[model samples]
Target: MKKVAFIFPGQGSQKIGMGKDFFENSDIAKDMISKASERLGINFEKLLFEENDKIGQTEYTQPAILLVSSIANAIFKETSNIKPEFVLGHSLGEFSALVSAGAIDYLDALELVHKRGKFMNDACAGSGAGMMALVGLDDEKVETLCKEQREKGLKVWPANYNMDGQLVLAGLKADLESLIDTFKEAGAKRAIVLDMSVASHCELLQSAVENLRPYLEEFLIDSFEVDVISNVTAKAYNTKEEAIDLLSEQLINPVKYKHSIASKDEDVDAFIEFGNGIVLKGLNRKITKKPTLNVSDMTSLKKTIEALNE
Candidate 1:
């Protein structure tokens, strides 16, 4: 079997018709979506398939994304014999990774992340929370600039190390907006504050870390059936003990995504992203030379299986 890593996408990947192909074609997908809606007391069919505003809300967005990604992974597993060398996910996607690895059940993950998103939203509510994407700046430069801003009592901090010259920042909205010109002047080709209400993966989320821990404890299994690389440390973890700590800390730590992929690139012949979009696949193109295949729907799923089989 060809060695590969399975990856999942996080927030910013959700859309109106993410899992429709699976829902329309596969009974398995239909059942999973139905169960998720019942478990969460939210109509996932409307949230995932129809046009609505709640789908973008973080609490709803979390479970919806997980459900679709889980369905995609589940359907792929049914048809493909290839197993991953390891698994990893970005931000909210980490819980989906846990579900795929058998460290947590998919229903439990949906509930956990729904609460996780609520906690995150609650933690940052009214804090003027926001995020920014900075392109064309190196890590050290961005870190130094953020440190300088923080020394002046600003709330900005590096939030995501997506790839070389692409870093994201999280903090108060005004603070991030204030730095746009500063970042641009400092060699960032583009620096724009995202229209986000939650400041993720930074000290702004400290309260969320504690709020999310109990759920992690309650939902996670004893150990992983397949090792998952952590977004916090960019390292492999298997047991619930490690998962609890890393996953909680993940709330307040910048995702080391570029590091995680680059460090493990050679171990896998390719990557298969199970989700609604090619977001991670796009990132992998810049992070590693290894090809990334995605199973977002029936068409892509078949294509990915064929590619792997070849």
Candidate 2:
């Protein structure tokens, strides 16, 4: 039997008018957006469709992306006969996966992610921490370079171990700048810091994790009904407690995404990225070399289901 998996996108994938199609066409999608707006105390529809740059702000972006992805997933579940054998999410996308897997309620996940974005944004507001993408460099070399940079008082570390040759680093601005020269000298194809505000997946975000812990604990998590891969440990979480703790720790740890997808059972036939953008699809192809599809709108969803049926 060919198994299927659903993967959710993270912060960087959010764009204005992301889920407008579903919102206008499906009542289920509209209700989800409305509930998210009430729970988050903001107009999600306006922020998502009307505002051009406002939604990109971390506080709004995190929860907005989650809400859209979850709504899209719900639409698929309600409309299709296909069910995933497992679910995975990238970085902040992990919360969406957990919600879809029945480990946490959608309202809880939405509220938690809103707070998470705020905590992260505030934690690095004035500290000058940020992230960088290093292309064409092996993970081992990146790890070694981070170690060397940290010793030089720059406080840089690997944030996202994305693939065999692509890695993202996070740390103080000065440290990242210093490493750029070293990476280039070491024959790296390109090393550039992302324009993001927070240095996620690094110890620098420990303050954010501390602030988010209490909020996470308040949410009631039930036993997981489906396997949800964790970004922190890169493994499937079996229990509710493990899921909660892993999510809390995810803020302060490297997103071991390469390991998470790699460890999935070999029986998985296809990986469906259930939201905007093809970032996860590209990453999955690099990691597993399997067929992948991106379900962003009705057209893509229909095409994916049709292909699966064939």
Question: Model 2, which residues run further than 4 Å from truth?
Answer: none
Q: Which candidate ranks first by TM-score, i.e. highest?
A: 1
* Candidate 1 residue runs with Cα over 4 Å from true position: none
lDDT, candidate 1, 29-110, per-residue tens: 9999989888989999988888999988899999999999999999999998888999999888888899999999999999
Worst 10 residues of 2 by lDDT: 216-225
Clashing pairs in 2: none
Give a tens-digit lDDT track for model 2, residues 1-310: 3579999989789888899998889898899989888887888889889966768788888888888888888888887878788899999888889888887788888898888988998889899988899998888888898897778777988888888888899998877887788999887899998888788988888888889888777874767778898898877776767876888789888998889888884858888888777889888888897788877888888888788888
**How far off is residue 128 in model 1, in Å?**
0.5
For model 2, what is the alpha-carbon lDDT of residue 148? Answer: 79
Cα TM-score of candidate 1:
0.99
